[model samples]
Target: MDFVFLEDSEWKSLGEFISTKWRNKKLVILCDENTETYCLPRLLAENPDMLSGTEIISVPPGESSKSLALVEQLTLALNDLRIDRNAGLICLGGGVITDLGGFLASVYKRGIPFINVPTSLLAMIDASVGGKTGVNAGILKNQIGTFNHPEGVFVYPAFLETLPILEKKSAYGEILKHALISSVENWNHLKDIGELDEIGPKEIITSMQVKAEVVQQDFKEGGVRKILNFGHTVGHAIESWSIATSRPLLHGEAVAWGMVVEAELSKSVGLPLEQFVEIEATVRNLFEPIVLKTSDLNDLISLMGADKKNTNEQLGFVLLKNIGNPVFDQFIDSEKVLSSLKKVFEL
Candidate 1:
């Protein structure tokens, strides 16, 4: 319920917020190599007066960097630099940095105030605000993380200009899925948003509000929060599979495909058939459908079996009562899921 406007205007408000939240504390601005080069310098330059005692920090990028090895190193860095409970950590990149920064802030001196400055659209909408922070453990994604709230999250669409176009569209997959599973309000926002090339401040603010409402309703995801996982249950499985393979897909790309497959599966389970078709059409128009070879699908399925959401001899899912309303229902058979997937891919 601790929400703040994450916008371009508020970029320097970050320093002011930090100054107020952790008065007289040191600032630790964290970034990855890419964001350091592209986004961090501009960020630091914006509020030279605000972050007077700030130290710019960087780590090698990627989900792989979230390991215990990195955490220990960061802990050492903080200690060496004399960072104390009075200080704050500012994450100035995408989800990987957000995750690592959140974990470090939580464990560093038993928790310190932290701010999330999510640069990517995906991070802006999904990873940045939710308080779900962690690193991948072996094949598992976010297997080791925490559910600690940030002091505030600052989302600047301006930072998005530095992002690759593909990553932008990929983030759209999550935003679009939000449209599908949430409300016609979101649907209209996407449809009327002029061009996919321009998602403006309106859409960004709207997306944050939508997600904030959901997170507030179910912070721990014990019930209604399951809605947020609409595409992710299987999408994450694909994530693990992709990482294991040489051609790793971005998080949004896997979710893009996963949303399509699950929509088809929903129909097979006796939901209205048109909803599935509607879902398929919407995605196909936005993203080119990826046709997985039989072997690749097999690999993907193997990865699905390892999902933490699975139960004894059966899979669990949060299916739709209808679009905009999600429900958590158990007893999904793997064979039935595969059958539905075959229908979508025709593989």
Candidate 2:
């Protein structure tokens, strides 16, 4: 219920961040060295007083940082600063910062308030909004986590200007989900904003709205939220499989392939083949179609079996009846999931 986006160019004002608002008692800004250097200074300069006398902390970057080691480090940092009960955490950066920092805030003093300023597209449209925050306990992507809705969220498209092209592409994969699963209008809208510079705040926020509303209805992901995981089942597995090998796929890339495979799976379930074709074309046109060998597919499938959504000892999947409508919690025929991979890899 505390979710809202900031408007006006002054949305990035750091000093004003804590003032002229319904913010908590005190704010503790969390960022990594990368965002701290590139984003914080400019933000602080504009809203000088908001962060005055506030402690800003930085952690290491990359997926590895979403580990217990990093969480321990952050806990010590908070203890040192005496950031106690009542102070809220403001996470700035991509998913890692928000996930790890938000987790830290959750465990710090047994729970406190937190806010999100997602700088990357993945975080802005998905991670930052869901309130699923945590660090990887081992090989799991989000093995140890808690669902703690941030006090507030602010997304700036300008933050993406410094994002690497790969990272930008990663975020786009999620945006594609917004369209394919819920609104074909969003799918059509994506044609105009393929490039990062071309992406506007309004469009990004709109994309987020689709997801936000879904989660608002099913915050625990008990029902409607499952639609949001349309491609994620296979995607997360592929991502983990890819990471375990010499090559690691960024989250977006894996999901891109997952969507392709699921689109085919959709067809096998009676969704017209044209829907499949459009899905394949749209994803390949946007992302480099991943070509996994027999071994990679085997490993990926093995990983998928471990998915939490599995029921009746069978794979449970969500596929589209058509664009703009998603059917969830259905048991997809195993052969369909496999055969579709053949078509996907043929590309």
Candidate 3:
């Protein structure tokens, strides 16, 4: 996928892309209520010539919008708008918008072109770059999805300014995950930052590059790309559990805790004690802990069993061998998993 880091004159490139490549295509912008309010106006003002006739589709903000029910509603909306196969979709929000919009574009009329305009830091670095699109199955995260790339990804770092403080902090979990899985140099660069405000566009681009490189090597996630799931196996289960509770944890918050738990699991695979300590400290420093009850353990485990990453009923994981090195497709027995989960939560 083509990536454009929209800076001073770079915004013009997005307009050029639309005007030249999708000039005659019916354009639609898919965003959440948040972006429709904060971002859509700026986008339209900046690219009036190219996006003049573009239609806007807005869903409510947050993870709940990622559901098959929402997808069906969106399909009907598109049909009502008379959007045809030749239309183009612009995903213009965080992960949920991009994931849902991409999935809709892929399935509508057997696939129409889509572009990603990632408004949130999380979407810019992870969701919009991976070409992975899907919605949740009930409380399960991304249980149904597809491997579909957008025609291009347009990243505007300035959009992050509109995010709430918590939202900005939440993205750091994914940033830390990328650094841990990529190299020691990247980890070192990120490990010391005390505030989310300390992270600038350069750090954001670095994280995006890490994901983009990994995706290029394993677009279908058949092998090498599994390393990117380092925190996600346990993270996803925690996220699913939190979603069902009154106090839902943001995706990155659960991931931060997952990295801590998985770092403990890394011990069984020979990860050095010192590295594990650093990983835990770094994650905990950036994110508040999620209080997990002993009663919650069984449910969390059950959620893991339903994860698509498992093989033959065994839980598959990507555990760290070192700070920069990850080992994927490691199937750990329930005994060890239980032990690690218990130990991490001090249960």
Candidate 4:
């Protein structure tokens, strides 16, 4: 699992690696409409010789593109292009593209090699780094997927320049999650950031390192890696519920809110009130709280039931004993879960 920061001379290394490694293989660049317009040209310009023969495939942008129907269509397109087991896919967009492309490559003809060229901050620090790849099932998030690593992950920080302000802010949710679950020092560094623009390569790399270390220890998420799911359980449910509504939240935005509520849940176990307040203030400072209605609670709870982290019908969560001290696989009763949602969302 090589992670290269494609700044300055590093882009040449990527070109050389592609030229030598995928020279004889058919290469397909998978992106969304957003990346195609803003990123693909730069990629081709930088790796002209290596990617000259590569084919381009662009799907509509956003979370909706990660679906079974699109997978089927993309599969058929690959087949029509005569893509075989040796073919490689270059996922060249944000989290949704990387997740969908990785899943497609993993299952197509019993798997094909792929590399991620993540253009968004969210994908760079989280999705593209981890081996977890999947698409949503109906309204649920990542309900269908696999644990498949990419050939490599090449990140170009310049890509962030093309992202809208909201998109950039969205990534801080995961960034905050990493800091909270890793160490007090990391927390202190991130807690008082005044603007998304204040985040630089150092913050991004620190977040990526946190996740990479966790994944290395638990590639299958049998134990420690579960810590990475700190905010995801409630986050995913809220994300799913929002998907069905007219106002949809970005993945990281939902996760930020989830962390706020889950931090409240942590108090019942051992997380101190002062630490919880610190966590809540940091998250709220970075993201606006989503308005959750009383009517939404039942639907959110039902969605949580479908979470893969659950075991034997009990909802499992990763709670904090303190900032940077995460405890995973804590099962809580549905009643408490409901109460936490009510308390946080003020339902």
Clashing pairs in 3: none
lDDT order of candidates, best first?
A: 4, 3, 2, 1
Q: How far is 103's C-alpha from truth in model 3 (Å)? A: 1.3
Work out the TM-score per prediction: 0.90, 0.91, 0.90, 0.89
Please give, for residues 199-253, the per-residue lDDT of candidate 2 as tens digits: 6777678778888889889888889899988888789878887766666888888
Lowest lDDT 10-mer window, candidate 2? 306-315
Error of 1 at 134 (Å): 1.3
Output the worst ten-in-a-row residue range by lDDT, candidate 3.
Answer: 306-315
Clashing pairs in model 1, backbone N/Cα/C closer than 3 A: 6-155
> Which candidate number has the best TM-score?
2
Write one digit per residue (lDDT tens) for candidate 3, span 1-347. Answer: 35545553348778888888888899999999999999999998888778887899999998899999999999999999999999999999999899999999989888899999999989988889988999999866789999998888888887888989888878888999999999999998888775789888789888999999999999998899999988888998998899778888887888888888888999988899999998888877777777889888877877888433342356889999998899999888765777788988889
lDDT measured at residue 115 in model 2 versus the true structure, 0 to 100: 82
Q: Look at candidate 3 and tell me the lDDT of residue 283.
A: 75
Error of 3 at 249 (Å): 1.7
Model 3, 161: alpha-carbon shift in Å?
1.3
- Segments in model 4 whose C-alpha atoms lie over 4 Å from true places: 4-10, 244-246, 293-299, 306-314
Cα lDDT, all candidates: 0.77, 0.78, 0.87, 0.87
Let me know the TM-score candidate 2 reaches against the reference structure.
Answer: 0.91
